[model samples]
Target: MSSFAGVSVLDDGMLCPSTMTFVSTSSDCGYHLLVVKGYARTKETPNGQSILSHDFGVGGYRWSIKYYPNGIISDRADVVSLYVHRLDDDDGKHVEAKFSFSFVDEVEWQNPVYIRGMKTCSFSSDASSWGFYKFMKIDALERLMNLDKDDCFTIRCDIMVCNAENDAGGTQVLLPDIHRNLNNLLHNKVGADVTFEVGSDIFSAHRCVLAAQSKVFMAQLFGPMKEGSASLDVIQIKDMEATTFKALLSFIYTDSFPDMKEDEMSQATEEEAVKYEMWRQWLQNLLVAADRYDVQRLKYICEKELCKNMCVSSVASMLVLAEQHHCHRLKEACLKFIQVQSPSCLQTIIASKGWQHIIATYPSVLNELIAKVIASNQQLVLK
Candidate 1:
């Protein structure tokens, strides 16, 4: 009988589905909580002594959570006891139900460590209280109090009373897709107060969004070194291409990249290869732009993609790019690729078109490569 709670802004400001994050039960299900004040003092009560909780209502029946700070049994004296008490008279009507007893922290993320009552247990005249004799160890309870200065603790009970009418099916509720809002903002150009001129193409973007995602944008758009403080002016980007910038904006808004049709590599058409190379170059440029902007996640995505595309033909040039961009992981990968055989594989890589550029521009990288080769031989010798 429960309905969708719609979307809600979390404490961290991200929009999320209320059903999963806010509520975990239907209308038929209900909750009961027991807050024991001066919880540490309860240890003096000794074994077999218990403290009954205040009454709570669920499924038209009066119920109370039972707590034993110093356990209800002799052998289990070191642990606390907990139970659900059926308070109403044993009417034999609507007495079947399921319940969970869980200890939660202040920030109530779902704890997997909870005791769920057997599904549909009958609350008959034979039993008024049914629960765990040893719910939580006293040491665990002490650790809970150490998290905060408070002398209090709480145990929650979630109850779902069974019904014949509810046996048909559960209600269908749609979860909130939060990214759709950002997608709409991006494509619809709502509140986009900044423009970028990249070569022949112009893009509309939000300054705040960009600043939040990239440190370069933060400095240039809102802080010192601002380029286009006046919203009417276009910020000139001399280096990045339009396609690369577009993909970058996509990632900033939706945290997802535009789909690159990499599967088309099998087709091997002139047009397809051209298209693929066009995107490949864009991806490479995207990494450089990401690095410049100080967008770590985007830079990581670019690095991972480049690594997946790495081959003998491109590893040498990739090594040079990695060194220039300060991409340590990519440099390591390329070094490993060439470290196979210095005379054969290394020479083959050295004969590639990019090696001449590397020799002329980055002589230090050549030294590092030789050092890596020596280290590899040393490791082999040691083994």
Candidate 2:
């Protein structure tokens, strides 16, 4: 039960006498009363103001005031309260109560304590009362206050949608393309251990990788998850040398690669073209690692380089290699390159001991090569 006093109401042309009080019967704030004063607003404000102002409850509430024929005004009967009243029919028969009273005052506060390091703040419609809601932690308090603040500061409260911006910390989360569908994954392990910290402090809690088949190099930016398991799209890197792996890890922690200069790419005796080839091989190893980790951009770099060094000899070997590793796209690309450059190229390579191994492994492919070779030689016969 709850109760309050100092409420006032007004009556007709003449001031009436009536008083009402608040009484809480149930678990919640129940009813209120108003004490009516005989006269309401008669002439106007004592200062001869055009419009009269009543300072009571804040905005979003009803105001009840009444005026009598005589110059006298009743402040009691003019009171209005939102609390409901439940009186028996026999208790009162339209008692001509003219005035009523109800008092409403806003409680002001200085600076509220701010709660720092809040990871999340949530709310429910029927979970708590207004008083309880007002006294939540500063993070929650801030969330509620955000309701009154500018749109920019308001913490979006949708349960399904996460905040669009990254956290203030170094955490970078790559979200799935189907953000709506993947919302449920937040509760999963793949979601929990995800976090990012720049120097020492964590800036973000999750950085999601969207594409399942894209190549990624987590070691290049923000070291590996260290504790959780992850999936990758492709695996190009075979066994990285101990030093190379360390270099890659360092790059991940700090966005800087080691001093891999052009001069260092080859020995002095090797041809300049061979030097480029060495660099290309080194890059291919890096691409393998990147592709295995689902880093799409890195995979593209590897493909670009391979295309630049395109040749009939390498295409057949690349096709066999790509197929062996289940690199469907890469295999198709290499096969297409062979078909376009020289259709008989694979048959010629197959006769060599080095490539005969592949032809034996794929006898059906050998038949396809023989047909292509015969077709190519048909032009020679016509000449």
lDDT of 2 by residue, 137-218 (tens): 2232235435234211211000111122223423232222243233334324254334433233322223334223222434
Error of 2 at 210 (Å): 13
RMSD in order of candidates: 18.3, 29.5
Worst 10 residues of 2 by lDDT: 152-161
> Measured by TM-score, how close is model 1 to the native structure?
0.53
Model 2 residue 11 lDDT score: 36
What's the alpha carbon RMSD for model 2?
29.5
- Cα-based lDDT at residue 292, candidate 1: 87
> Which residue runs of candidate 1 sit more than 4 Å off their true CA positions?
1-177, 227-232, 266-276, 341-345
TM-score of each: 0.53, 0.30
Residue-level error in angstroms, candidate 2, position 346: 6.3
Stretches off by above 4 angstroms in model 2 are: 1-238, 242-270, 336-348, 351-354, 367-383
- Indicate the residue-level lDDT of 329 in model 1: 81
Worst 10 residues of 1 by lDDT: 6-15
